[model samples]
Target: MSVTRPVAAQFEAYNKRDINAFIDCFSEDFRGYRMPAETPSTIGKSALREFYISNRFNNPELRAELISRTVLGNKVFDHELIHGISPTPLESIAVFEITDDFISTAWFYFP
Candidate 1:
């Protein structure tokens, strides 16, 4: 199956602020990193859940609009326009690596 399913599912879950569903898109040992960082900012589903619950899902105004998506093999890249987390809209490129139908690793780039 295509890796795009998990990527798209997570996007929908993010927009809806559905923490459970959002985390469900990721693997149990998921690793998430912000660009330029050498280590994963968030690791494991438990950590991922805690981070998003406090930093994202709790923010009522936060929403990410998908600008575009490109998938190559097991990786999915997304161009996103985010609103409400800051004073202005933020542009980000997020890459998701899927394994066994779940996202195993992710990288977020803000430029």
Candidate 2:
């Protein structure tokens, strides 16, 4: 699969609130961080699963509207409008690094 495939799957699964499908898009050693911060917010697939189950998958109305997507080699940058996570929608950027058909790392940024 192309590098962007897993990234695309991630958004689709997220919108559907499908925890299993969302986790499937990531590598076993997947790591997620907040942009401009060095420490990881989540490490490994199990941690990611716990994070989504606790903070995301339970939100029935959660959705990410893709505003734009830029792909450079194995990296995909997505600009989006995310809703249902808070009282109001938020604009954010998600940077994904894909390796061997799975997302290995991700960074999220909000302004």
Best by TM-score: 1
How accurate locally, in lDDT, is each candidate? 0.95, 0.93
> Ten consecutive residues with minimal summed lDDT in candidate 1?
51-60
Q: Residue by residue across 30-99, what tens digits does model 1's lDDT show?
A: 9999989999999999999999898989998999999999998999999999998899999999999999
Candidate 2 residue runs with Cα over 4 Å from true position: none
What's the residue-level lDDT of 110 in candidate 2?
95
- Residue 74 CA displacement from its true place in model 1, Å: 0.5
The segments of candidate 1 whose C-alpha lies over 4 angstroms from its true place after superposition are none
Model 2 over residues 63-96: C-alpha lDDT tens digits? 9999999999999999999999889999999999
Per-residue lDDT value at 89 in model 1: 94
